[model samples]
Target: MIDQANKLREMIRKKAETEKKTKHQIKVYSIVSGKGGVGKTNFSVNLAIKFQQMGKRVLILDADIGMSNANILMGIETPRTLLDLLKDDLILKDIIAKGPYKVDLISGGADLFYLEKLDDKKQHEILSNLAELDEYDILIIDNGAGISKQSLTFTILADEIILVTTPEPTALTDAYRVLKAVSTYELKNKIKVVINQVPDMDTGDYAYNKLFKTSEQFLKIDLEKLGYIFSDIRVNKAIMEQLPITIINPNALASTNISQIAEAILGDKEYNYNVSNLKQFKNKLIRLFG
Candidate 1:
């Protein structure tokens, strides 16, 4: 009887381990830029699609506050947004909209601005609601251009941050500034760079090397080159039609680059799953602001 009980317990333990391994742990990635018009929203929307294509459940959180427009790129509209959740006390599931590739979306609209003035009770309520969403494998938060208190909060709380910038000198300067601002938080999240709208491979290489070396030398932090998007006309064409470039033209250079970026990002999946990512992010947000 003792030996039989031991064998049964071993089987139960193995089953539990397998279940844990297969369970999805949500990873929050904040996609930000130093200035506007660097294709940050476009990257966020399409990158979420790429992750979804890899068989992971992905959600795009358009946390751009007053400039929330990721839905425009996804070709969907959310009648109910994060604002409705805060104001109407609606559950998160009700506010979520299905976008391209069937990825989930939560449009923050202008209502996200209220995050600054959230009372303790409201903060807890919001965090609690967010914690309830464990079905997603990834959450890509498309933050507004330029740094603000609200945007900074989201950036600091993410599991990783992708700083998008162009090859222009001004864009590089702004990207460096974004890195500087993030460094103030003594952040642990991995910071990656995506050189968007580059005219050629040389331009992309120059941009990445500039940003990478600058961050490493001055900020004392290393930045990863996630990948770069070519200056492809298909990107704009897809934007006009309200479709992700990946779906509109998977063969497009921009689409292919994004796929490579997704693969690079997922290359480190051998690590143990972090099941408490959302909870930890929530706690930090509340503790710091609540």
Candidate 2:
């Protein structure tokens, strides 16, 4: 009887280890830019789809506050936004609007009144509920232009941040300023750069190298180059028609770049990132904001 019990105990321990290894928490990524019109929202919408393509459940949060318009780019309209979930006590699954492919989206409210009214406790409650859903493997938040306290909060809480910029000098300068500001936060060190709307590979390389070199030399932070997107006519056409470029023109240059970026983001499955549970996510939110 004693030997049989020992064998069962070993089997249970191994099963627990295997289960823990397979369990992955929802990875939160905040997509931000120094200014608008840099294709930030469009990138966020498509990237979420790419993650879904990789067999991972993805959620896109249109947290752009006053300028939130991700649904417009994806040609999606929802009667309910995230505020409705918090106010009406709706489940996360119910608030999620069906998005492209396997991805889901959380519509943004016109105004941030409900978000602003949320105290630390209230915010924690919402996040705890969100984490409990476990229906998504990742959450991508598309923030508004420039830097604000609200955007900063999202960046600080994120596991990774992708700052999009263009080849223009002014845009790069503004991106550097944003980078400098965000560097003060202790947990925001894993920031990456994405040069968007480039006309060619040369332009893309120049934009990325300039930002990477400047960030290293001046900001004293090693900003990794995530990937670059070529400016394609298909992208403009899709945006004008309120459609995602990838859905409209799968073979377009921009679409190919999106796929590559997604692959690069998922390059390694070895490193175990912090898997914050629902309660831990709530506690961290309260602690960070409190």
Candidate 3:
């Protein structure tokens, strides 16, 4: 009887450990672009909404410096931003504003640029605050266009990166530049490309292949084509109306394309997420700053 009881206890403990390892983990994806006006923020916001519709808790961190426009697209006002946390002694919970479909938004803006200059104490405070966001299933970081220290830091630390680009020649060259910078860091995070504003599937493929082949040949970096967004006029209308295309017209070609990308992301089973991802990411950022 004693032996049987001990055996049962051991089995239960092992089962609990196994379940813990198999549980879903929060994912962090940084949406970045090499040039402005590539619809990076638009894609980030809509992707967040799609993830929310699919029953995932999503948060969009508008880390676009002075270009923190995700709130504008979400039709919400950011009364407080990440700056408030450092300057006003506010907590992360206090600055997080709710957007459409209950998505969380944090306007980091230029405030994130100051993070690297913070002392260890302030960094710890910010880290503690970020810990409260563990309930979120996904974090979409909308980085500023072009390369910057802040953007590259987030890109390197992110679990995955979505590089948005257009079919323009300038856009493709700039996109390749961003990949080159990432290659210099020797980070192995998965980088996915999203060709936005494409007139057709061939245009999208051409854009992806340009970046794909260039990065593969020059930087030896493998790229995945997440998907593309068509040039839908409804996208413009939705932007002017302060709503995401997905919310205003889910049937729009652009909206459907974003939904497909979201589906593909969730369907990918190879992502290994650790519960300590946020903490690890924070530590890595701090080290980079150091």
Question: What does candidate 1's lDDT look like per residue over 108-143, in tens digits?
Answer: 778766755778778677766766656787888899
How well is each residue in 199-238 modelled by candidate 2, as lDDT tens digits?
8889989888887787777674668888889888889899
Ranked by lDDT, top first? 3, 1, 2
Candidate 3 whole-model C-alpha lDDT, 0 to 1: 0.83
Q: Where's the lowest-lDDT run of ten residues in candidate 2?
A: 270-279
> What's the distance in Å from true for residue 245, model 1?
0.5
Candidate 1 yields a Cα-based lDDT of 0.82
Query: All predictions: root-mean-square deviation over Cα?
Result: 5.3, 5.1, 5.4
| Candidate 2, position 84, lDDT | 66
Higher-scoring candidate on lDDT, 1 or 3: 3
Candidate models: Cα lDDT each = 0.82, 0.78, 0.83
Candidate 3: misplaced stretches above 4 Å?
A: 1-24, 86-89, 272-278, 288-290
Which of 1 and 2 is ahead in lDDT?
Answer: 1
